[model samples]
Target: MTSGDVSLETVTAAKAGDRKALEDVLAGLQDRIYSLAMRVLVNPDDAGEATQEILIQILTKLSTFRGESALSTWAYQIAVRHILNARKLRDRDLGLTFEMFATDLETGLVADPPAAPDQALLLNELRISCTMAMLLCLTLELRLAYVLGDVFEMDHAEASRILELTPAAYRKRLSRARAEVIAFTSQHCGLVSNQAKCSCPRRLPAALKSGRIRSGSYPNSAGASVDYAAAKQQIASVVDDLKTFKLQQAVPGQMCPEDIRGRLTRMLSHPL
Candidate 1:
């Protein structure tokens, strides 16, 4: 049968509460759902639990689906809600920022004469752990916005519909999510570090020279070398503008920590 025929069959069987059909549907979509969950939860254990919960929810709610949207869309919506609720239950501090999760997985990967076996193993584990952690820091709304837009490559309108947000609101959330990812990358991945000479705009050439960043290649769950040159440039421009503004407000000699904190708060409060 064609793909559509198969999907229809699965839907019918799923509605009829066929356990094998439910299992088939879950198996078919497991990787996509798992990857999205991992990206949002940033923790493999949490992602796995969320994935299981999502499958269970899909099975239970399959009959309620009224054909208002495609089966995939309905599945995505359920997964998104499951992940969001899981995050809420775990993290009481809504102020939890994304910076805490972005670790430098590429560290020591380019050591001289190649890394020793243990060092190599450690680096590999770090990459996997860091990617999982990064997914956990994102807010539910931002995570859904990113997964649908970036991973699925859905257009803004389509993403908005899946997310149940206005086009403008979806765009705004997407922008914020992108910014958070950029900032988290810069802070955690040593994307802007003086030690490796990998700071933002300058890191692209360095990363290529060291063979740390690959183009058009996808890495499995562990981590992939990303083309962050453009993202870095954009984020760097924002950082530079902020730095310039801060310098402009400086009164030369006396600086108070509280005053600096207040200024930083104000800067962050401003829209990008």
Candidate 2:
């Protein structure tokens, strides 16, 4: 899954002390691991540290691979769990609710785009900025479940496994998350809904001036899209109404500050 080649054999080999198999699994998962952290932590620097810790945890626990879950699923469990704990200790709450978002949007306190070039590159930066900031507004648990289940398009069972919750509990979390986010966007966020005044294009100028996104590397290379049809079924129509739009799945490029594999591998070379 993600980038890791999945097979019963690789899991068995990894469990049987095959270092190469373990490395291979990590190699395939490195991007996804960082990507998850980027979404959960909402800060690239924190995400980098979380990736290092997650890899180490996986490495130390490789022998315990029970095969009940896919290797990627197991890895994701470690990542999400670790992030939840880290966020609790760090106290980085977004303090956002539907009320706040609606108020901000209706009052026009959100992004104030200045004069700037209207290009796809600038648009990418705006998307990244708005999405990341919006994620910050949600509660920690809600944000993780929403990202895993909705944005990344992980099924309920798989997302639940990663969150170490039963299917029912996970489903409720995901539903609530989707409802709140969808309702807010329907009334506010310009990315998916129309009522709100702020959109990515309108905000890119201000983001550029504040150094939120750099000029170069602002535009992300076109990425393959994930199927959110299942998540769509769970969420209401606000997101599904978007046609050929990137809002549902597109994230800003350059959200990750470093190459996850390189950073973690380098960290592993050092002693505790």
Best by lDDT: 2
Candidate models: Cα lDDT each: 0.52, 0.64
Enumerate clash totals for all models, in the order shown: 7, 0
RMSD of each: 16.3, 5.4
lDDT of 1: 0.52
Instruction: Looking at model 2, report the run of 10 residues with the lowest lDDT sum.
Output: 224-233
Query: What is the C-alpha lDDT profile of model 2 across 1-272, one tens digit per residue?
Result: 22235576776676666666666667767677878887767666677878778888887887777777777888898887788777553565557666765554344333554544546555655555556666666788888888888788888888998888999999999888877776666656665655567665565555565676666654332342322232223233434434212454655323334466666556545442
> Candidate 2, TM-score vs. the true structure?
0.76
Candidate number with greatest TM-score:
2
